[model samples]
Target: MQRVRVLVIDDSALVRKLLSTMLACDPAIEVVGVAADPLIAREKIKQLEPDVLTLDVEMPRMDGLTFLENLMRLRPMPVVMVSSLTQQGAEVTLRALELGAVDFFTKPSNDLASTFAAGAQEICAKVKLAALTRPRVRTIVRKLEVAPRLSADAVLPRAQTPDSRGGSRIIAIGASTGGTEAIRVVLEAMPPDAPPILITQHIPAAFSGPFAARMDNCSAMRVCEARDGQPIQHGHAYIAPGSQHLLAMWDGARYVCRLHDGPPVNRHKPSVDVLFRSVAATVGAPAIGALLTGMGDDGARGLAEMREGGAMTLVQDEASSVVWGMPGAAWKLGAASEMLPLDHIAARLLELARQPIARAMRAVT
Candidate 1:
């Protein structure tokens, strides 16, 4: 079997050595070369033609982001960013994802050896995952003119009525590898009065806050990170905090979001399975579950439960997925009510939202 060749780029000698050592420990990974800066890394890329590149965010000569932008435009290849955990680091790392980075690893601040020791398996796994994903060309994002944010309660149709104690409608979404872009594509197409959305996109704690902010800037809906015990309001999309499981619970009057600090389910904190199951158990038939481009089966079983409970389930087709692992698994289990390409998902969701509660209830029965 051919090993995945990797090029390590970091300004810190210690970081380069530590990363090289961690990657080398995995027999399937081969350290082709290491560069102290992007200038040196640029030449190494031409020479070695590594399968993956581990890049640092802040680097000498040229910053990683600028280099990455050029690389994606000139020669698109899978690149995993090794970023610091500071506020600035988080912001830039999110931009790297926007610029077509396959994934990222947060640099440990203290006790580097011990931290990397704990995360060695994760690092190698991400590298392997990156190797399998197709590299996308970085495109120039046209800036949208700033507009006033609208409240959902003001414009969206109310799910509640005096005649019935009907539950609120929600859309639950989950993704992992290549999820940032996937989530962005779905959210960007959402109308102003779209259903309340809850998302669990596998990410580290430091990056989640910035990611929510970025999503808010790109989408029409009010996007924010989920907080413990927060009310699940209409016209707002909530992203699960990176290190916690987001659960939907009823508080007598309305459905609210709750964060759980339990052991990782399916080896993922804020696991897609955790979120999907909560929506299935609490929201039931009023929910819509979407399993998009990702690398694992974290959401397949939970999505099946959602389908059994009469909720609509959609999976992105393999042709449009970066890895096709999660949605493919869900499709194989007969969990998906509809399987569509990424471009059509948002429109399908809006169409589902148009169905009257009476009709949706009938379908559930």
Candidate 2:
């Protein structure tokens, strides 16, 4: 197998060296070159022609976002961002994902060397996955302009009715690679009355808050990072906090969000398996499970469990996935009752959300 060639770009020589050294530890990865800023990166890109790039969010002469935008337009390739563990860094990292970065890693707030050492495996793994990703060519950054907030009832007219209420209906979604934009597309297209959504996307703790905030700003549905004991509500979506696994549990009458600090499942802290299995056990047939674009099989068995538990299951078709590993695994297990394209998922979910529990179950399979 050909080793993946990577270019390291950071204003800090220490960061550049650290990144280069960390990536080189993997025999399958080669540090082809290093650049201090976007200007140098641009030139190195031409000369080295690397397979993947590790970029810094804040760099002298040219910021990472602008450089990524230009790179995607002129010479599209895989990129993984190295971001600071700050609010500002989180915002920029999300923007980089929107602009075409395959993924990002957050630098710890204290003890940089120790943190980097601990996260080296993750860094190398992401680089390998990014190398396999197909880069999309978007000439301009996708605008995430804020939209007017709509009440839950605005989309789901019967949402407030006692009979049409909470515990009986639920939606669980999971995604990883290229998930930031994929999730936004789904949420933006959903109706106001859509059932409460539970999401577990692979991301660091520092970025989850900003990711939720960005989702809230652009989506009609109220989006926020999940807190332990928060009740699930209609017209809102709860994203699993970074470093925690989010599970849905029934408290006699209604379902509520629960956070767990269990060891990483499938090598992901907020593993999709944990969330899906919890929903299968709690919500049963009334639940709808959708596995979007991701790079591993974390959610496959859990999604299959959801299906066996009588839930309607959907998997994003390979044609639309950034990396079809997770969804493909589920589909192979006969976990998904429906295989749909990305654009159709939101509308299908809304249609299912409006149906009576019995009818929703009958409509699938």
Candidate 3:
């Protein structure tokens, strides 16, 4: 088998070295070349002509975003943004994905080990998967001025909402790819006083903060990145940070979040599986498990586990999924008690919040 060839592009020599060496350790990946910035990378593209490019968010001579914009216009290839762990970094990484890069992984600044420890396998696998995709021709795609929203086909409205007359039940959401748009619909449908929501989106650590802020500004729900020891509350939403796993723990009657720098699950630091499993144990049947659009089978198995544990499970149907990987997997497992479109996820959860059976089961469990 031909090893997946990769081009490492960064302004920092140390980062170039670290990234190349780490990727090289994988038997299926080979470091084709390393460039200190986009200028060199542009030249390497013509010379080495690697299968994939690992792009840095910021670079000298030309930044990764501008270069990526040009790359997609001229010759499209799969690119993954390597981002710093900052709000600014988060914004750029999200922009890169919108601009045509594949999925991103966070690179911890203070500790090199943490960056490589969790995402090593995923990095290699993504590079290979990306290489197999049809490469785009160099044509100036008018940058989408606005992120695409899910069409009605993408969402199925389940029930009318505002279950603000609530109990302690909260919402747990997991999504990938088209999730940004899918989430927008669900959150928009939610009432301001809706139950507390916990979300795990497969995004880089650098991007979760801004992503949450973006959602907060757009939706009725107040969204923020989850912090350790933060008590689970009503009327607010917490998103799992990119570089850590967000799990829930029950202290007597109250639930607080615990953040751990553990090895990645399903090749993601803040894996949906980890969060769903934690909710299944902590909130039991009270929480609603929603599997949204995304690539791969990351959250499918875990959502299924949640359903078996007696949670009301909702899977977005294939018509609504951009990739149909995660939600489809859950459906195949027979986990989803209700299969709906992306638009309807919020209404269904609201109805669940109204059900005494949901909270009653949790209290007993």
Candidate 4:
């Protein structure tokens, strides 16, 4: 098996060393070269021909974003961002995703070496995942072995019967890795008075609020990080807080958001499985579930449950996904009623939103 060759670019010597060390810890990743700035990295990229790149947000000579824009326009390949955990960092990282980065991870504010060491597994995994993305150097498909993890049951129990309590239709969406940009594309295309959207995208606690704010700027609908016990309203999109699990619950008379402080389901705090299962139980046939571009199979099982409960389900097609793991898993499990490209999902969802739940259920059945 050919290992994933990587180029590490950072202004900080310590960071460059730390990143290289962490990546080397994985047998599947080979640190081919390191660069102190984008200029040096540019030449190294041509020389080493690395399969993936770990780029720093702040750099000398040229900023990471500028270099990324140039690289993507000229020679596109998978790039993973290494950023700080500050508010500014979160904003910049989101921009990097929009600029076509496959994924990102924040460096520790203090105790850099120890912290980087502790996150070695995650760093290596992200690099390997990036290697599998578009403009690939080679085709490398390997199933990563993950430790046993808790399911949606750890947060919310599966309903014996679909709740069927809500009067209006609801939309549930989940994604990770390449999801931020994909979600932005879908939400930006939605009409102002579209059905309420509930989203779970795997992200750090510091980034979710900024991500929501960014989405709100471009999307016609009001998009915001969800608040506990908030009323679910039409023309609004609610994103799960990075630190808590956001669940859609029918509060006797109306649907509301309930935030849970449960253990990480599927190794994620704001897990897609938890949100999807909650929607399946509380909204039932009136809900529409879509699983977008992401790494891992976090939402696949929950989407299947949504289908069984009579909800219309959709998965993003592989050709349009940055990483097809989540949506592909759903496709393989026969969870999605239809698999569509990223550009067409919003229109299709709006079409379904206009139909009566009973008729939509009949169509899917």
Candidates' RMSD to native: 3.5, 4.0, 8.5, 9.8
TM-score of 1: 0.90
TM values, all candidates = 0.90, 0.88, 0.63, 0.90
- Sort order, TM-score high to low: 1, 4, 2, 3
Q: Give the Cα RMSD of candidate 3.
A: 8.5
Candidate 3: worst-modelled 10 consecutive residues by lDDT = 137-146
Deviation (Å) of 257 in candidate 4: 0.7
**Model 4, span 1-365: residue lDDT tens:** 99999999999999999999999989999999999999999999999999999999889899999999898889999999999999999999998998888889788899998999999998899999899988422111222223344568889998775454655799999999789988988888887778899999999899999999999998879999999999999889999999999999978767999999999998999999999999999888889999999888999999998988888899999988988999999999999999998888888888888787777556445
Model 2 local distance difference test score: 0.87
lDDT string, candidate 2, 1-365, tens digits: 99999999989887888888899999999999999999999999999999999999778888889999999888899999998878898899898998889888887767878789889999999999999988865322233343456666777776343642323779999998888877887887765656899999998888899999998987778999999989998889999999999999866656789999999999999999999999998888889999999998989999999998888899999987878999999999999989998778887887776678886456444
Clashing pairs in 1: none
Clashes within 3 Å, all models in order: 0, 3, 8, 0
**Model 2 clash pairs?**
155-192, 155-193, 156-193
Model 3 misplaced regions, further than 4 Å: 1-8, 11-51, 69-77, 85-91, 98-100, 105-122, 132-168, 175-191, 201-211, 228-234, 241-271, 281-286, 293-301, 316-328, 338-365
**Full-model lDDT, candidate 4:** 0.90
